[model samples]
Target: MQLIESISKRHSPRSFDNKGIEQEKIELLIEAASWAPSAFNNQPWRFYVAEKNKNPEFYNNALNCLVDFNKSWAQTAPVLIITVVKTTYDHNNEANKFALHDLGLAIGNMMNQATVLNLFMHQMAGIKFDKFNKLLNLPQNMEPVSIIALGYLGKIEDLPAEIQKVENEKKRVRKPIEDILNYSPLK
Candidate 1:
């Protein structure tokens, strides 16, 4: 698929089919994320992939870590990918401010790749921080940034009325380039 077309078609899929994604496809999606650019090449992103049927306990635990609102629709996705990043890059460094941005780029790459592969992805931020930290056994230095739900998309009828309306509209709107870009500031 063309890059622009793929990006335009990529939307958060709230309803997913129960069918499992092929292992090869999952690997390809991760491989796409692996190549994203990082600040000074300080690649700090880590991913934890959990499948529902294979590990119900872990899946439920992770799902429970999401906010109640997210849990409603997220349960439909067959796979959940937890994205994390280590804080310290070296022994002397106490901070790395760009880790989140780097992770975002990686995730964007992953989503686009999924669209190219005829898969759907939903990146979510509504998570219960405390529960997630404890359930995932995350080290103090590693920060869990986001959760990505992956699977094949279900029919439009499966979505809530509001969401179904938006999907059916098929309109993609974004801030105009002029509004986002600036050349010079008034003195």
Candidate 2:
């Protein structure tokens, strides 16, 4: 798919079908993430993935990390992924101020790649930090970022009433460039 088309198609779908994604497709998404640029060439992003059928324990663990609202709908997805980043540069052991930004870029790349692969991803920031760290036994230096639920889109009618309204009204909306862009100081 063209870049613009992929961007236009991308959406945070809350419901998913039961079908499993091919391992090769998942690998391509990760590969896209790996190609994202990082500050000082410190590729700090890390991804932990779990499939419901392949590993129930792991999938359930990932599901438990989400906030209650997300848990309700995101549970239907076939794959769950947790993204983290090393907090500091390895060689110097100094704080990497751009680590989170780099991780965000990686996720953006993955999202577009998923669109290109005819898949969908819904990313959430409402994660239980302590629970996630404990469940995964993450290193002290690694910081959890977000959880992503992936699969093919399911019926929007299955979503909660409020969410269904939003999806039905206008699935996508964004601030116009004129409204968001500014070069001069405000009066």
Candidate 3:
């Protein structure tokens, strides 16, 4: 049994090359994300991009919003994006429970596009929420989700010695499908 090459090759690495991503590729990632299905077709996902080469100051500001641990390694990535979501439906002022899920779908699409472009992405939940919210001056109805670092693979040596092997050389593993799928009664 075979899987999509991009899906199988996709991986999250802490080490990223300093080379900048081309503008066209970045637009393609966003285009893919924009097409993800959303509840009521609201398309709540919003991206705050910081390209190291194009917007260094904003890139540094975005980097500062991440926790120290993430900041340490994420700095090497050429592109950083903070995904934001609208918490309420645009047609009505009611809450949208599926906002986050929709955001995840959008990010998934973006990551798949990245893989096709030979780029890798590492999505981190280690953000300073308060700082990030304030940094972007986000509205009450919008929420910051996760920070994503995107770039080409870098030397394992660029990562801290403690995690070098773990990040770049470790074997990939996943739980068996039987462990996750409910083939029979839950009991």
Candidate 4:
């Protein structure tokens, strides 16, 4: 079975070259994200970008917000983005349960765009949200969810021996369709 080239080539790579991404490419990625479907067209996704070349202070601060493990590798990337979700709907001012899912869709679009641009992206859940929240002075309704490191692919040898070994050894895998796709709920 063949998949879309961008979709098939999209895999999280920890090693990243320090080359800076072009501003136009970044804008295009964000534009692609904006095109994603949102519940009620709320468009609740907000991105905080820190580019090593354009915003070194913000880049360093965003890097510090990552957990130690992620920071170790993510520091090599030239671009860092924090994906924030608006917890409330814009029109109704009510809690939105689909905001997180909407954010995921937006990120999916961004990831595909990155792949199309021949850039690599690694999304990490391990972030120090407290520090990030304080750094951004985020309001109660806006919650930081994930941080992404984006850049060109780097030499695997650049990573720590343990990570390099894991990177070399691991292959992308998925559960069988029977295990994942079900018409009925599990008992």
Q: Tens digits of per-residue lDDT for model 3 on 1-187?
A: 9999889999898889999999999999999999999999999999999999999999999999899888888998999998999999999979999999999999999989999999999999999888888877888999989899999999889888766756756777899998998968987
Tens digit of per-residue lDDT, candidate 2, span 18-61: 79989999899999999999998899999999999899999998
TM-score, every prediction: 0.88, 0.91, 0.94, 0.95
- Angstrom error at residue 109, model 4: 0.7
Higher-ranked by lDDT: 2 or 4: 4
Using TM-score as the measure, the top candidate is 4
Q: Looking at model 3, which ten-residue stretch has the lowest summed lDDT?
A: 161-170
Question: Any residue pairs clashing in model 4, and if so which?
Answer: none
- Order the candidates by lDDT, highest first — what do you get? 4, 3, 2, 1
Between candidates 1 and 4, the lDDT winner? 4
Give all candidate RMSDs, comma-separated: 2.6, 2.3, 1.5, 1.3
* lDDT of model 3, residue 4: 94
Error in Å for residue 66 of model 3: 1.5
Query: Cα deviation in Å at residue 132, candidate 2?
Result: 1.7
Which regions of candidate 2 deviate over 4 angstroms? 1-3, 160-171, 185-187
What local distance difference test score does each model get? 0.84, 0.89, 0.92, 0.92
lDDT of 2: 0.89
Q: For candidate 1, lDDT tens digit of each residue in 1-187?
A: 4559678888887889888889899999989999999877777798988899888888888889899767877888999988899787654567878888888888888988999888999888899988887876777888888788899987778776766675688665789989988899956
Model 4, residue 137: C-alpha shift (Å): 0.8
User: What residue runs in model 3 are displaced by over 4 Å at the alpha carbon?
Assistant: 168-171
